[model samples]
Target: MIRLRTVEGDPPDVDALVGMYADFEADDRAQGIPPIGTDLIRGWLTGLEGIHVVADHRGEPVGHAVLVPVDGETLELAIFVHPDYQGATIGTRTLGELLDCGAAADATAVELHVERSNDAAIALYRKYGFTAEETRSMELRMRRPLVTPPVA
Candidate 1:
């Protein structure tokens, strides 16, 4: 069974999260993109609201997703699923939950920068209704309209 936990602060599973991201970077390098090493990931972690949501299976972290505010109305999402857990619909669910995070921030939209050549991720984003708003030779800028929460 898969479980999703909203981490209130730094997750206790930081090591596992970093390992998953490292594997993702290797995947990127395999497809001809620059390797995003631990330094970049570390820098990003520091600037983030230090929030994380972890997906676990049998007491082990299998996926991780984070939301980072980009501007007044935009939040950037980054997700990494352990390679062994790929193709299990985890990415789709993780992304959907990430989108929900925007609502809590009072965001009107969410955006993410993805490699133009990463067809798998592009398809996943499209499945979640994210549309390409702009593109460069190497990257695509995608956005999704946020779901507004009802006033309490």
Candidate 2:
């Protein structure tokens, strides 16, 4: 069974999450993400300053979703599901839990950039209400608004 939980109050399962990314194939990369090195992985995780969630199956991480603070009020969103666990409901659950926490944290909006060729990911983001704000080359920048905007 897959279980999803927020990474909080502790160091988090960094190794397990790293293992998931390390297992990724070249085709699974998104705009050159999940960078290819232990140092890079650790550095990326260490720099996160917002909500993060992980999906675990039998104590091994199979998916991860995070919302990192950017431009003060906006958060940058990212979600990854290990190839072995793709097509299951893990990504949806992980993203849902992270967004729930982000909302409670008063997130005004969250943004993500995904490759245009990745229809599956685009559909998933759209299902969560992310709309395109810009498109450059092969990447689309999408934003999901959580709170109402103030008057001009």
Candidate 3:
């Protein structure tokens, strides 16, 4: 079973996540992400700021999603699922949880850049209401508005 949860104040288990990325398939990369080496992956993960969620199976991370602030009211979103865990709805659930976290944090919008060739990811983003904002070379930019809850 896969369990999903937000990463709170404490830092995430970087080594475990690195291990997961290490096993990531090269063909699965999009827009040059999930970096390419141990140090690069660690640097990228540690430098990210904002909400993070992890999908764990048997206490090991198999997927991750994040909503990083682009400004006060907007955020940039990214998600990745280990190849072994793809096509089983983990990406969909992880993305839903990440968006929920973004809405709860009061973000007004979220954006992402994906390779134009990544049809599966683009379809998933569109399913969640993201629309194409621009196309730059091999990448496509997409954005979606988040509806925050009413203030009490």
- Encode model 3's per-residue lDDT on 78-137: one tens digit a residue: 888999988978889989988888888888999999889989899999999999999998
- Each prediction's TM-score against the native? 0.78, 0.91, 0.91
Clashing pairs in 2: none
Residue 23 displacement in candidate 2 (angstroms) = 0.5
Looking at model 3, the pairs that clash are: none
lDDT of 1 at 80: 69
Candidate 2 structure quality by residue, lDDT tens digits, 31-120: 778888877877677766567788889989888888888887798988889999889988778878888888888889999999999898
Candidate 1 per-residue lDDT, tens place, 1-152, comes to 99987764455465565555667646544323223777665555544573467889988778877776788888877776777888887878878777776677678888888888879999999988899999988899999889755799
Error of 3 at 91 (Å): 1.0
Judge candidate 1 at residue 77 and give its lDDT. 76
The true-versus-predicted C-alpha distance at residue 140 of model 2, in Å, is 0.3
Model 3: which ten-residue window has the lowest total lDDT? 5-14
Off by over 4 Å in 3: 8-11, 148-152
